[model samples]
Target: MEIYIVGGAVRDRLLNLPVKDRDWVVVGATPEQMLAEGYRPVGKDFPVFLHPDTHEEYALARTERKVGKGYHGFTFHTSPEVTLEEDLARRDLTVNAIAEASDGSLIDPYDGQADLKAGMLRHVGEAFVEDPVRILRLARFAARFDFAVAPETMTLMRRMVDEGEADALVAERVWQELAKGLMESKPSRMLLVLRECGALARILPEVDALFGVPQRADYHPEIDCGDHTLRVLDYAASQGQPLTVRFAALGHDLGKARTPRDILPRHIGHEIRGIEPLSELCRRLRVPSDCRDLAHITLVHHTKVHQAFELRPATVLKLFKECDALRRPDRFRLMLDACLADARGRLHFEEAPYPQKAYLESLLAAAAQVDAGAVAAACDDKSSIPAAIDAARTDAIVNAREYWQRDN
Candidate 1:
C-alpha cells in the first residue's frame, strides 16, 4: 500500500544533482484498484496513472516484452505481485535503475549505487538489447554523467548496431535522444561513443566521412577533419554554451568533408553547399524548427562574419538583417570559437594567413547586438537612412535613453 518515489528523481537526488522530474511506484496496487482510488489512467500499454492530489506520475510495477520491431514494439505486463526490483531491472543504465523507498531508504537491486559511486554506466540486464533505443540512451547517459560506458555494455551496444537492431529506431526517437545528448554538460564523449559503436555512420554518413579526410597540408597538418571536429566539440564543452549552439559548433565545418581536394588548399563556397545538406539533415533528424534556424545561421554567417573586416557597411548590415531574427548569438560565438579551435589545432595554421585579433574583436563587437527591426525600419525609409551606415549619434542617443528609462 506504500507509494515510493523512484527513477531519475531519486537517482539525481542521491547524486546531489537537480531532481527536476518526479515519478512514483505504487506497490500492492492494480490498474483497477488505482482507478478506484481516483488515479487517472494514462498508459494504454501499461498500468501508469496520475495521482489525484499530486498530479505526479504513478505507475504500478510492470514488466515489458518486445512485441515486434522498433522502439514502440513492446508489450507491458502489470500486476499487484510485481516487485519494484523487477521494474528497475528493465531500465537502460544501472545508475538510473536505483529507486528511493518511501522511508527514504536507497534501493539498489542491481548495484546501481555502486556504479554511480564508481562513475560508471552499466546496462541493467541482458534484456537491454530488447530495444535498440537503449544504445542512444546509454550514449546520452555518458554525456550527462561524463561517465564511461562499461566495456561489456558497449559490446552489447555494438552488437545491437551490427545486428540491424538499430535500424528499427525511428528518426524521431534517434533525434530526440541525440538532441538530449547534445544538450548535456559535454557532448564530445557522446559523439566519440556514437562513432565507436558505428551509430554515427547510420545517423550521419557525411560526418562519418570526415573521419579520415585529409585537409591540404598548407592549411591543416595535425589530423583529419574528424579529429579536428572532436577538438571543436571539446572547445564547445569548455565554453559551456547551450545545446542549439553546440549543434551548430559540431556541424559548422561538416561541408568541408564533402568538398573535392582537387581544389587543393581551398574549398571555395563550401559554406553555401553545406547549408542545404545541413538543413535537410536537420529536417530528417526531426530537429525543432527553432534549432534548425540557429544551425542555418551558423552555416551562413560563419564565412560572412569572417570576412567582416573587408565588408562594406551595406553588406554587413545585410548579413545582420539576414540573421538577426534567428536569436542565436550563442551559436555565432561558439562558431567563432570552433573555427579558432580548428585553426589552432592545424599545423599549417601556425604560419597561415589569419585575421588579427584586434580586427576580429572589432567585427565581433559590431555584430554583438543588432536591432533587427530598427534596421528593417531604417531600410524602409525613403527619406535617407543611409544603408548600413554607423548608427547616427542622434539615433544612438534616443535608443540608449529608451533602454535606460525602460530598465529604470
Candidate 2:
C-alpha cells in the first residue's frame, strides 16, 4: 500500500501555515490490507482507518458520486485501483486537492498550487454542485484564509442555492459550520459570502434579515443593521474574545431587523424585542446553553450596559442581577467585551473610548464586596435580611459609581 499526506496538511504547508492535523490517503490498499497492517478501522460510511503507530486518520483513496441530495447523498467507492488523481478530483476546493508523496514530491493534478499562490478558492470540478455543505465550507475557508472565491466557483454556489440544495442542509450541520466560521479571524467574510450566494437566508434567516434594516445614523453611522452586526463581530474578534462573546456580538442587533417601518432609524425598544429572534435562532440551531445564555443577556440588556452612567445605582444592581453577573463573573466579563465591541463597531468610532466597561467593572466589584452575611446579621427581622442585603449592595454600587466619576 502506498500512502501520501493529503488535504489540509499539504494545503497549509504550501501556504506556510502551521499544520495542526495531518490526513493521509492510502492508495492500493483494501480494508483487509489495512487491518493486516494493524490499522484500526473507524469510518462508518467509508474506509477510514487509524494508523497503528501515529494514530492519525488515514482514509482510503476514494471517489464520490452524487446519488441523492444534501451532503449525505454521496456514494463512495474505494479500491486498490482508485488512482490518487481521481481521489483528488472529488475534493471540494482546488487548493485542497493537492497531495504530497512519500518522497516529498508534490502532486498537482488539479493545479492546487497555482490557486494557492494566487490566493484563490476554486472548486476541483463541476461535481462541486452535488453537496450543499460545500457552500458553507467555502464561506468558512474564505473567512479563515481571507481568500477570494473564484467567480466560477461562486457561480456554482449561487446555482446550488437557487436549486434548493442549500435548503436540504440540516440545522445541526449548518450551525457546526457557522460556529467554526464565527471563530475565524475575519468571520464577517463568511456571512458576506453566504449572503452573496443567498445561503444566509436559508441557513440563518434571523441574521439574513438584518441586511436592509436601518439604524440611526448618528449613533450607528454604519446605518445598516446588518453591516453593524458584521462590524461588531469583527471588532469582537479583534479583541481576541471567545466564541460565546463573538456569538453575542453577532446576535446583539437582531431585534433591529424586526423594527417597525414607521420608527425608521430609531429602534427605541429593539434591545428587548431582539430576545425573541435571538432565542429562536439559538433554539433552531440547538446552540449550547453557554452561548445561548450570553447571547440572550446581551440582546436583552446591551443598551442598558451602554447607558450605565445614566442609570440609578439600584438599576445598575438590577442589571447585574438580571444578567446573573454576580454568580458568573467570567460570563459577565464576556458581556462587557461584547458591549464594548458594539460601541466601537460604528463608523468613525473604531477607537472611541469605552468608559462604560471600566464603570461597570467598578460597579460589579463594589456590589460583590457588600457583606451579605453582615447585612443579614444587622437586620432586625428575618424577613428584612434580603431587603438589607439589597440595600447594602445598592449603596455599594452608588459609592463605586461616585469613585468612577472621580477617577475619570
Candidate 3:
C-alpha cells in the first residue's frame, strides 16, 4: 500500500499554519490488505482504519457518487483501482485537494497549491454541488483562514441553496457547523458567506432579516443592524470568548429586525420584541441549553445592562436575580461579556470603554454576598424566606453601588 498524507494537514503546512491533525490516504490498498497489515478498522460507511502505531486516521483512497439528497445521500466507492487523483477530485475545495507522498514530494493535480497561494477557496469539480454540507464547510473555512471564495464556487453554492439542498439539512448539522464557525477567529465571515449564497435566510431567517434593516445611526454608527451584529460577533471572537458568549453576541439584537418601520429606527421596545425570534431560532436549531439561555439573557437584558449606571440599586439587584447570578456566576459573566461586545460593536467605538461590564459584575458580586441559607433560617415563615433574602441582597447591592460610585 502506498500511503500519502492528505487533506487539511497538507493544506495547513503549505499555508505556514500549525497542523492539528493528519489524515492518510492509502492508494492501491484493499480493506483485507489493511487488516493483514495490523491496521484497525474504524470507518462505518467506507474503508477507514486507525494506524496501529500513530493512531491517526487512514482511509483507502475512495471516490464518492451522489445517490440522493442532502449530506447523507452519498455512495462511497473504495477499491485497489481507486487512484489518489480520483480521491482528491471528490474533495470539496481545490486548496484541500493536495496530497503529500511518503518521500515528502507534493502532489497537486488539481493545482491546490496555486489556489492556496492565491488565498482562494475554489471547488474541486462540478461534484461539489452534490453535498449540501460543503457550503457550510466553505463558509467555515472563510471564517478560519480569512480566504475569499471563488466566484464559480460561490455560483455552485448558490445553486445548491436554490435547489433546496439547504433545506435538506437537519437541525443538529446546522448547529454543528455554526458552533464551529462561531469559535473561529473571524466568525462574521461565516454568516456573511452564507448570507451571500442565500442559505442564511433558509436556515437562519431571523439573522438574515437583520442585514438590510437599518439601526439608528446616532447609536449604531454602522447604520445596518447586520453590520453591527457582525461587528459584535467579530469582537467576541477576537476576545477568545467561548461559544456561548459569541452566540449571545450574535443573537443579542434579533428584535431590531422586528422593529416597526412606522417608528423608523427607534425600536422602542425591541428588547422585549426579541424574545420570540431568538427563542424560535434556538428551538429550531435545538441549540444547547447553555448557548440558548445566555443568548436569551443577552437579548432581553443587555439593554438593561447598558443602562446599569442609570438604574436604582433595586433594579440592579433585580438584574442579578433574573440572571441567576448567585447560582451561576459563570454564565452571568458570559452574559456580561456578550453585552460588553455589543457595546463595542459600533463604528468608531471598537475600543470604546464599556464600564457597564465591570459595573454590573460588581453589583452581581455584591448581591452574591447575601447568605441565602442564613436568611432562609432567619425567616419567620416559609414563603417569607425569598422576600427576606431579596431584601438583604438589595441592601448589599445598595452598599456596593455606593462604594463603586465613591471609588470611581
Candidate 4:
C-alpha cells in the first residue's frame, strides 16, 4: 500500500506554520489492507483509519460530490483508482490543496505553493460552487493566513451569495467558520470580506445593521460603528492573543446598534442588550453550551472593566464577586480584551502622540491579579468592598505566578 500525507499538515509545514494536527491520505490502500497492516477503522462516512503506533489519522484518498444542500450534503468517493491530482483539484482553496509523499517530496498539481508564496487564496477548480461552505471557508482561510482572496475567487463568492447559495448554509456551520475566523490573526479582514460578499447579513443580521450606522465623530471619529468594530478586531488580532480574546474583540460593540440614539452617541445599557443578541447568535450557530455561555457572559461584561476602574474597593470586589460567581474566567478575559480592543480603536487613541499602549498594558497587568472567585464571593456577600475595588489593580506578576502554580 502507498500512503501520502496530505491537507493541513502539509500545507502548514510548507508555510512554516506550527503543525497543530496531522492527517494522512493513503492511496491504493483498502480497508482490508489497512486492517492487515494493523490500522484501525474509525470513520463512519469514509475510509479513515488510526495508525496503530502513533495514533495519527490515516484516510484513504477520496473524492466528494454534492448530493444536496448545506455543508453536510456531500457524498465522498474513495478507491485505489482516484489520482492524487484529482483529489487535490476538488479542494476549496489552492493553498490547502498541496500534498506530500512519504519521502517528503511536495505535490503541487494546482500551483498551491506559488499561491502560498504570493499570499493569495484561490479556488482549485470550477467545481467550487458544488459546496456552499467554500465561501465561508475561503474567508476563514484568509483570516488565518492574512492572505488576499484571488479576484476570480472573490467574484465567485459574490455570485454564490448573490444567488442564495449562501442561504443553504446552516447557522451551525457558519458559526463554526466565523468563530474560527474571529480566533484568527485578522478577523476584521475576514468580516469585511464577508460583509462585502453579503454573507454577514445571512448569519448576523444584527451585526450587519451596524454597517454605516453613524457613531458621533467627537468620540468615534473612526468612520462608523462597523469600521470601529473592524478596528477592534484588527487590534486584537495584531496582539496574537488567544481565541476567546479575539472573539470578544470582534463582538464587544455588538450592543451599540440596540442602544438608544435619542441623544447623540448614546448607548446606555447597550451591553445589557448585546447579551441577548449575542446569545441568540450562539444558539443559532449551534455553538457548544459552554462556549455559548462564555460568549453571552463576554457580551454582558463588556462595559464592566471601564466602569470598574474608578469604583470603591467594596464596589470593585462586589463587581468581581458577581463575575467570579459566574465562575467563567475564559469569558471574563475575553470581555476584557474586547473592551481593551474597543478603547484602542478610538480615533484619538489610534493617532495618539501619548503612551496609550503603555497605559493599557499597565491596566491589563493590574487587572489580572483580581481573582474571579474572590470577586464573585465578595459580590455575593453583599458587603461592599468599595474601597478595595476602587484601589484594585491587576498584578500581572502575581497572577502569572498563580497560573504557574495551578499548572504545577
Model 4, position 294, has a per-residue lDDT of 50
Q: How displaced is residue 41 in candidate 1, in Å?
A: 2.1
lDDT of 4 by residue, 1-408 (tens): 677777888889888989999978888877898999999899999989999999999988889988977778889999888888877888888888888887889898888899989999999988798888888888888888889988998888888888888989887778778878888777877887788788888867777877876777776888588888888777877777666666666566678877766853766777787877777676677766655655565567656656543444344444545666334445555556556677777766764432322333343445555564465566744555544443444244334335544654
Worst 10 residues of 1 by lDDT: 356-365
Please report, in order, the local distance difference test score of every candidate based on alpha carbons: 0.72, 0.92, 0.93, 0.73
Q: Which stretches of candidate 3 lie over 4 Å from their true place?
A: none
Q: Candidate 4: TM-score? A: 0.79
Local accuracy of candidate 1 as per-residue lDDT tens digits, 283-331: 7788887667766777766766656556654455455457652245444
> For model 2, what is the error of residue 267's alpha carbon versus the real structure, in angstroms, after optimal superposition?
1.0
Error of 1 at 207 (Å): 2.1
TM-score of each: 0.80, 0.98, 0.98, 0.79
Tens digits of per-residue lDDT, candidate 2, 25-98, equal 99999999999999999999999999899899999999999999987999999999999999999999999999
Which regions in candidate 1 have their CA more than 4 angstroms from the true location?
A: 216-222, 263-266, 321-408
Candidate 4 yields a Cα-based lDDT of 0.73
For model 3, what is the C-alpha lDDT against the true structure?
Answer: 0.93
